[model samples]
Target: MPAGIRLFLGYAIAILVLIGLSLRFVIDQAISMPVSPLGVVVMALLAYTIFTTTLVLQRKEAARGLAIGLASLTIPGVPLAWFTFAAGPLGIVLAGLTALLAVALLRGLTGQRTREWLSEP
Candidate 1:
């Protein structure tokens, strides 16, 4: 699988499982099957934003797409914040930090196909 796909799935699945564990262990509640519908939506949006920016970068709108990608990194934090309540704002901060790392990781994935993608043509 592509790194982007792998990375996305890794984060998605980890977050889901974490959601379960957080509810069970941290929040002292039973695991809800779907957890949160909004979580699914947030993941979808984050995935869309990540891949589309990559698509745009490959299509020659490199700078713009990269900026969008960087800006969008914080998207995942929203769902992480929403679903995991015990962590408070710290969870949000860490998620945003994770997202920043994800931006570079994603850039590595997207840029792997073309070193020139982020450079002036």
Candidate 2:
């Protein structure tokens, strides 16, 4: 399988498992399956994966962009997973921090000056 497809499948499976676990929590409590905050985080990551795949599939030279984008996604995703699991306002802070970190990592990987320019007033 192509690298992007492999990534997509792995993340997709992970997302499904997370959702099932969230639902199990509700079921155990005998309550309706309200959306868990963790579910939102997982969904966001899954969306990121899908978006990256779309970018790769649309490019003639997918390697350059695909590798950079995937690295960008992973850079903060690892931390975001921890933050989201912790829950509450701390989770929000973690998500924002993770996004900022991801942008920096992406800039480094792509050799793009967007971050430098954005830092200017």
Candidate 3:
């Protein structure tokens, strides 16, 4: 596998871990009242991410687009990280790191090596 794919897989795994950690909050909200629509949407997106990651691992040509789409989704989070930065200096550091990671992921996914590797049989 190419470095780009490896990076994306790592990112996907990290996202899955975060989703797992947040499941308790999502479930608690649901148990106390009506299901949170945001939770539902997040779950759906998680499923899609998992599916796309699997396809990429299999080296399916279509996965290039799917993976690119997934990487693109992270772009919005860069600015959103600023909301967390309001908490403290730690938040500021975290926000900067997250923004950097998002930008790197986008570049890695769209890099020429990644495109060539994914396009191969």
TM-scores for every candidate against the unseen true structure: 0.33, 0.34, 0.84
Candidate 3 lDDT score relative to the true structure: 0.82
Full ranking by TM-score: 3, 2, 1
Taking the tens digit of each residue's C-alpha lDDT, what string does model 2 give over 1-121? Answer: 3433344445445545765677555455444435656556656665765665454444424434554655555565756665666766776676666666556545553553322222222
Give the TM-score (vs. native) of candidate 3: 0.84
On lDDT, the leading prediction is 3
lDDT of 1 at 118: 42
Error of 2 at 103 (Å): 14
lDDT of 1 at 12: 44
